[model samples]
Target: MKTLLVDDHEIVRRGLKQLLLEAFPQAVFGEASRVPQARELIMQQEWQLVLLDINLPGGSGLDLLVEVRLLRPQAAVLMLSSYPEEEFAVRAFKLGAAGYLTKSSVADEMLAAVNKVLTGGKYVSVALAEKLAIALGNPQQQALHETLSSRELEVLRLVATGKTIKEIAAGFSLSEKTIATYRMRIAVKLGLSTNVELARYALQHHLVD
Candidate 1:
């Protein structure tokens, strides 16, 4: 089996590689710390599975997921993030991820998720399953954050965590002006006027820490 791991943290990649190696001893692994490096490896090789970090330094992993789908329709792509399932699982599915798992998940769960995807099945965790059930049962009761685009939601989360526009821009490798635009859009969508309002709303809805 051929697999690729894309994450900014070298320790995370090393740790996950160890876990995966335990499960599939013969698996050949590739590591990338940024989107560009991942993209280059994707273009050059065919992978059976790609474990993608949703938040990347130079680009959003969601963006890379779309590209991966186009580049290798048969490749199984699983989204891995530190964020909650409510924050990104639905969007990851919409972007063609075979599965979405939080970094806190147990190694066994991770292996099962990877195996499910390898066999051409979708993997949704118990937590995400419950959220999906709730959303389906109460479609009209969706939170305001649900209405925001993925990028807008990301910016809002950063704002909620007390990150300034400059800090958010640096984290996303985007311009401060672009982040400001996203912040404005988030404000408009959430019916909130100030950054404080945004932060309060996110906290109230449990969108961020």
Candidate 2:
């Protein structure tokens, strides 16, 4: 099977490779450290499975997930992230990711998720599953952050983390003015004024690290 791993950390990529090798010795792996590199690889090849990290150098893995769905629709993507945040997981699934997994998940869980996704099934952590259940059961109880678009939520997360416009722009490869506009839109939507307010909202909502 051809598997492509998109993560910025070499150690993470290596660890995933090592873990997967125990189960599938014949697996062929390709690795990419940045969004651009991952995009190029996706355009050039067909991967049976893709292990994609959420946090990348210039953008979130969600962006690449969209690209993969378009360029290699047959590829099953299992999203990897350090954050076990339910909001992120929800966005990922909505974007067509086959599975959402935290990096902290046990090897067995990871393997099971991989197996399920590769078999054309979807997987989610138990915690995420419970959260999703509650969310779907109580649609009217949706949190304010849920109203934000994926990009808006991403901007909010970065802003809540105290990232400056320049830094956020650099990470997104967007202009400072564009970042400023996002900030303004976020403030307007949230009805919040200062960074402190945004940070506090994020913390209260468990969006911030």
Candidate 3:
């Protein structure tokens, strides 16, 4: 089996490599710590499984997931994130991820998720399962933030947490102008102006830290 791991943190990549190696002993592994590098690797090889992080340096992992589906339609992509599963998993599944696993999840859970994805099944944690059920049960009661694309939501959270446009741009390796555009979109969607109001809305809605 061939697998690729894409995460910005070297320590995380190292630790995950060790843990996944225990389960996929014969798997050939490729690692990349940035979006450009990851994209290049993906194009250069056919990976059976892709372990992707949600907050990549140059882009959201959801963007990469889209690229993966286009480039390697048959490969299973499992998204990993430090964010709560409820925050991003639904977007991930919609974008064609085979599974979503939080970094705080236990090794056994991680293994189970990987195995399920590798075997042609979707994996969802109990928390995510509950969230999914709630959404299904109340299909019309979608959260306001749910309407935002993953990238837009990410920018909204960052802005809410007092990150300046430049800081948010740096975090995503995007230009300030690009982040400004996202800010406009967020304002237009949320029907709010000013960072203070945005911050207030995010806090009231529990969309940010």
Cα-based lDDT for every prediction: 0.89, 0.89, 0.88
**Whole-model lDDT for model 2 versus the true structure?**
0.89
Q: After superposition, how far is residue 154 of candidate 2 from its true place, in Å?
A: 2.1
Q: lDDT tens string, model 1, 1-209?
A: 99999999999999999999888999999999998899999999999999999768676788889999999898999999887888778888988999999999999999999999999999999888988999999899777788888788878877987889999899778899999999988888889988889889988876665
lDDT by residue (tens digit), candidate 2, 39-112: 99999998999999887877778888999999999999999988665757888898999999988899999999
TM-score of each: 0.86, 0.91, 0.86
Pairs that clash in candidate 3: none
Clashing pairs in 2: none
lDDT of 3 at 194: 96
Stretches off by above 4 angstroms in model 1 are: 158-180, 203-209
Q: Count the backbone clashes (under 3 Å) in each candidate.
A: 0, 0, 0
The RMSD of every model to the true structure, in order and in angstroms, is 2.5, 1.8, 2.6
